[model samples]
Target: MFQDKGALISLPAADIAKVRVPGSIFPAQELLALELREDLKAAVRLIKDICEDHGVDSLVVARPEMFTNGPTTAWLHNRIGGIEDHICISDGRTVRVVPGMTNHAFFMRLGVEKNFERFVKLQKRCPELIRGLASQINSAFTFPADASIPTVILQPAEGLMNLDPAFLPFCLVRHSVQATFDQIALSGKIDLTENFSRCSRLIYVPLSEIALQSEGFCRYIAREIAAAFFDPTVGVILALPTAETAESDMKAGIETLVEALRGIPGGIPSVASHRIVLASQECPESFLFQGSRRVELVLHNSLDAWLHPPEYYGRFDHIVVAASRATDTRELYVEYIDHLLGRRPEFYWLEHLALHPNDTGLIAAW
Candidate 1:
């Protein structure tokens, strides 16, 4: 069916009969063969149409790795008459089969100075030019880099007070119309100006009222918080349910968080052994405590040091604090845990400043 009218064609009769047998069990194989044949026909038609439109009499096939002896190249030469006369093949060290054109002429046309000898000498100095060109062409289209910034979650003042001192420096307070950084600073109980100078350590992120109302936005924030647990630069993340957050939304957020955490090297088992704390105001229905052994679930109104006692909190490697009103008690819980664990000296920022001062400037700009 692919051949022109009155054109002579060769066929392997046995092979054709085997594949074209009626009610064959190998339906998938037959379908694939048909699809491949149709695709080749389409490709040939497109190429012929392009050539006809441009009024081209010959085709120049330039390939960095094509071999004259290769069956595919030989078949292509046979299928397209006079294609062999215009073929150009390069094997890193040398270019061959230029036909009417000389190596020196080709090199000159390609912007190489002087002659082919100069091109050869340049290739010797930069071997990557010959090898990487094909790979560069192959990878011209790719997925864009992940440019989205981490979502910032703003906790209540009481919640912020309870945050682990180790994580305090990395915390970013969101300054919405509902609550501003200046208003929080005036409280006096929490020294927002001294500790968080120039909005450096504890920065204030201004979020629009629309963003705060978005459930999808809230879920994205939850995923970011969950992702932070695995990030070396990020310390403990304190997340509390806001008034707008529904139980379903909270469950969905937790599910996303759990999925992200489970992607760690040793999976959930390793995460359970880590010094991680998950504190929430209300228990989401999606949180599964089934297989987790080292995870301790503590239900308390306030994570006050005196009420819980040191030994009880000290026993577990990972703790999940669930309170009746988690938003109200989150800070106290984090504060209590921070006090119990004792703040370890963090020099990540100092190290970053020393190593990548420009990157730090970029971060500050962001």
Candidate 2:
């Protein structure tokens, strides 16, 4: 995770039962609510239980380009360390070990439009599939109704492939599938060989631009739309960095984000979220009082500004916010929440789904 222009610290080994690394997960969108380290461990335990109950050979894992080089990757690959049986694609083979993770370089694999499109085309040919698998390893996934997809990932060349516009449809779709792969599966093939390509900019929808009046289940898009789609509500956590360096970087983060998310309908504009940075910062509990005001807030948790709480906090009951392994040292996280819940669950609830665009072949450096 790049915070204030640098890397976060990796923590020592934890006693937790399991640690799940989602492919290309954005903290602002998918963190657990305030809770203890035990809570996170418990979630992982359930995943393990279900896998074992079903006589599963292994639980599929995935990561995308977005999460590749960030703080989360460092933590999973190096910091707390991986489980002995954890299967991560490494150096052309599936390695079921944790200690040597750093050697292969870490990544959250994704099943994006391009990857899937490519995989299907080659499914009929055994030799081509084997050749491609030798160079690039992959696994299958499915998701729930209006839920995000799940995926299994391995190592990539660069830490990650950063999309210039920031909003990556391929990355998004891959995330949705990875998140829900355990629950749902599509019925037919998505053939986009002619209209779109992984190398292309955007995936073309088969239908014309039909104005969507009703809310569909897409969290990332819905998040931006929260401002216009429903009544956009946001929560902001303002604090000054204890260190001079971090303070400057955090200020830039605010400015950059405000600038990037300028004119989208249902989006939480900058004027709404205030900027409050000071020399003295308070504890997470002290900031909790302001929770009811906005849907989400972003905070700085560098060594200079640390959050000393028993666990991570989230925006609504549906979401979870936890520190990335990177935070073990810096100890921090950030988010954008949605306020209106039960009142209008459709508009307010963030189901954490993704939109997989058409994919390209063997990308992000195998």
Among the numbered candidates, top lDDT falls to 1
* Candidate 2 wrong stretches, greater than 4 Å: 1-248, 266-283, 289-316, 320-366
Of candidate 1, the 10-residue stretch with the lowest lDDT total is 135-144
State the C-alpha lDDT per candidate. 0.27, 0.23
**Model 2 C-alpha RMSD to native:** 21.0
Query: To one decimal, what is the Cα RMSD in angstroms of model 1 from the true structure?
Result: 26.5
Report the C-alpha displacement of residue 141, candidate 1, in angstroms. Answer: 9.4
| Index of the highest-TM-score prediction | 2
Regions of model 1 farther than 4 Å from truth:
1-75, 81-222, 225-260, 263-366
TM-score of each: 0.17, 0.23
- Which digits, one per residue and each the tens of the lDDT, describe model 1 over residues 45-147? 3323334444543232323134345675555445444332221212112333322221110110111112223444545465433332211100011111232
lDDT of 2 by residue, 103-207 (tens): 111111111223223333433333322322211112221112232222222222211111111111111122233332222123122222221221112111100
